[model samples]
Target: MNILNTIRERRSIHTFKDQEVNTELLEEIFTYGSYAPTHYMTEPWKIKIYQEGGKTAFVDAILASYQRIGMLKMDGSPKSVKMNDSMKKFLLEIPHHAVIYFEKKEDLIRYEEEYASVCAFIQNVQLAGWEHGVGMLWTITPYMHDPQFLKDIGLNNEKVKIAAVMQLGYPDRVPKDKGRSPIQDKLEIITD
Candidate 1:
């Protein structure tokens, strides 16, 4: 598929079919992601993939974080229990999750540059995966900000920043395209 068409057609996939994506295919897609532009040639991105039985611990840590932050109730009431159960089930069903992060830089400008580079890398991964019949949902949930959650997931929060948690798999369903506004409105011509 052409780049323009891939950009226009690719949608964030929420539901995934119950199937395992091959590791080699995932690596190939990430290799494409590595081609993203970076400042000073610092490819500042790292990914920890979780799938199958591995997802349980990650999901538990997320639930713990949610409860710690008061986003989820831990009173053990039927309603809260049901909600947690449903959330666990939904998360577990996704075939893969990639926790993308990068080491923190002390310099403010350098930090921003690294973050921007990682963002570009993530977009490349998404686009490349879409072309191969895979879909990804780039999520930035509140739990990602929790220090304890980071520790549980084996990342040192003080030393690294989580760029995103990408949920990936063969899509169960693709959402309809919601058209974007004309770029002319946002674009500006500056001629001095």
Candidate 2:
């Protein structure tokens, strides 16, 4: 598929079939992902993949972290209990998870650039996965700052930043495309 078409068609998939993503296919996607530009040609990202039974520890840590931070609670609060249960179910269904980490840099500018590069790398992974009919959901949120979660992912260090938590698999269903706003309105041209 053409890049533009892939970009347009690619959607963040939440529902996935109970199937393991092939190791070779994962390699193929990341190989393409490595093509994303990096600062000073320094590939500052590291990927930690969890699959099969390995994902259990990672999932447990994330759920525990959420509970520790009050984002999830089993304190008999109806709303909290419901949300926690739902989130656990959603997380458990994903058979593969890759946590991308950005190695810290001494220079602030380089650090920022590395972060941007990693973000692009992540998008590259998603697009590349799309070509193989794989689904990816890019997530970074409520659990990102959790120390235990960081430790669980083997990134418990001041020098490393959690770039993204990618949920990977074969899609059971593709969501309808929610079109984007016209770029013309958001563009600002300055010629001085």
Candidate 3:
């Protein structure tokens, strides 16, 4: 697919088919993602993929984070218990999870630049994945902010910044486009 069409048609897919996307294919897509612009060639993004049996530990950490933050309350109430169980099952069913992160830069300006570069890399991953009939949901959930969750995933919270945890697989359903406002609404031109 052409870049323009790919950009327009790509969607954030939540539901995925019960299939495992090939590892080699995912590598190729990420290779394309690497072409995204990096400030001073720092190439700040890093990824940790969890799939199959590996997802169990990741899901556990997420649930633990939710409980720690009080977003999930399994207070012996039947409703809360059911909700927790349901969420666990739903997360475990996803075919793959990619945790994207980058080392923390101490300088304020450098940190912003690195963060922006990683964001561009993420967009590239989504676009490249779309061309291969794969779908990705770039999620910035509350669990991502939990220090314990980062430690559970074997990342040092003090040393790295999590950008997103991408849920990836072949789409079971694609949401309809919620069209965007015209560029003119947000754009400002200055010619002096």
Ranking by lDDT: 1, 3, 2
* TM-score ranking of the models: 1, 3, 2
* TM-score for each of the candidates: 0.98, 0.92, 0.97
Clashing pairs in 1: none
Q: Which ten residues in a row have the lowest lDDT in candidate 2?
A: 150-159
Q: Write down the TM-score for model 1.
A: 0.98
- Pitting candidate 1 against candidate 2, the one with the higher lDDT is 1
RMSD to truth, every model:
0.7, 1.9, 0.9
**Per-model lDDT:** 0.96, 0.88, 0.95
lDDT of 2: 0.88
Name the regions of candidate 1 deviating beyond 4 angstroms: none
Which candidate's lDDT is highest? 1
Residue-level lDDT tens digits of model 2 in 1-192: 999999999999888899998899999999889999986898877898888888777888888898898878868789877887788777878979899998888888988999999999999999999999999999988788777778776777576889889999999999999999999999999999
Q: Summing lDDT over every window of 10 consecutive residues in candidate 3, give the lowest-scoring window.
A: 30-39
Candidate 1 lDDT over 1-192, as tens digits, reads 999999999999999999989999999999999999999999999999999899999999999999999988999899999999998999999999999999999999999999999999999999999999999999999998999999999989999999999999999999999999999999999999
Q: Write the per-residue lDDT of candidate 3 for residues 8-80, one digit (tens) a residue.
A: 9999999999999999999999988889899899999999989999999999999999999999996979999
